[model samples]
Target: MITQTISLYNWTNGVIMIAIFGLVCLTLIGILINFMMSGKKKDKTEN
Candidate 1:
């Protein structure tokens, strides 16, 4: 019973780690897109 509980704990931790990783990846993509769009607008305005 103890071993089963430990196994479940490990599985839950792994799932949480994966979720955090995915969230960070999505945040990075959004920042990159915003940066690119802003840069293009700046360049167009300068010219």
Candidate 2:
């Protein structure tokens, strides 16, 4: 029973870690896109 519990804990933790990593990656991508768009706007105004 203890071994089964341990296995379950590990599986859940792994799933949680994967979800968090995915969320962080998405956030980083969003920030990068926003930065690129702002740069484009700045260039247009300068010209």
Candidate 3:
């Protein structure tokens, strides 16, 4: 019973970690996309 409890805790911890990592990756991609779009707009205006 104790081992089962410990395994459950570990499983939940891993899931939370993965969720956080995925969110961070998504945010980074969004920022990169925003930066690229803005850069393109600037170049278009300058030209």
Candidate 4:
């Protein structure tokens, strides 16, 4: 029973870590996309 509990805890921890990593990646991607889009707009307005 103890082993099972420990295993469950480890599994949940791994899942949480993966989820956090995914969120960070998604946020970075979003910021990069936003920057690129704004840059294009600036160029268009200048030209």
* Candidate 2: regions farther than 4 A off: 1-9, 43-47
User: How accurate locally is residue 38 in candidate 3, as Cα lDDT from 0 to 100?
Assistant: 88
Model 2 agreement with the true structure over 22-44: per-residue lDDT tens digits = 99999999999999988865455
Can you give the lDDT of residue 10 in candidate 2?
87
lDDT of 3: 0.88
Q: Flag regions of model 1 displaced more than 4 Å.
A: 1-9, 42-47
- 1 or 2, which is superior by TM-score? 2
Runs in model 4 deviating more than 4 A are 1-9, 43-47
Give the winner by TM-score: 1 or 3: 3
Error of 1 at 34 (Å): 0.3
Displacement of the residue 9 alpha carbon in candidate 2, Å: 7.6
What's the lDDT for residue 4 in model 3?
A: 80
Count of steric clashes across candidates, in order: 0, 0, 0, 0
Across 1-47, the per-residue lDDT of candidate 3 in tens digits comes to: 99988887787789999999999999999999999988865445766
Clashing pairs in 4: none
Error of 1 at 1 (Å): 16
Write one digit per residue (lDDT tens) for candidate 1, span 8-43. Answer: 768778999999999999999999999998887545
lDDT tens digits, residue span 1-47, model 4:
89978887687789999999999999999999999988875455766
TM-scores of all predicted structures: 0.68, 0.69, 0.70, 0.69
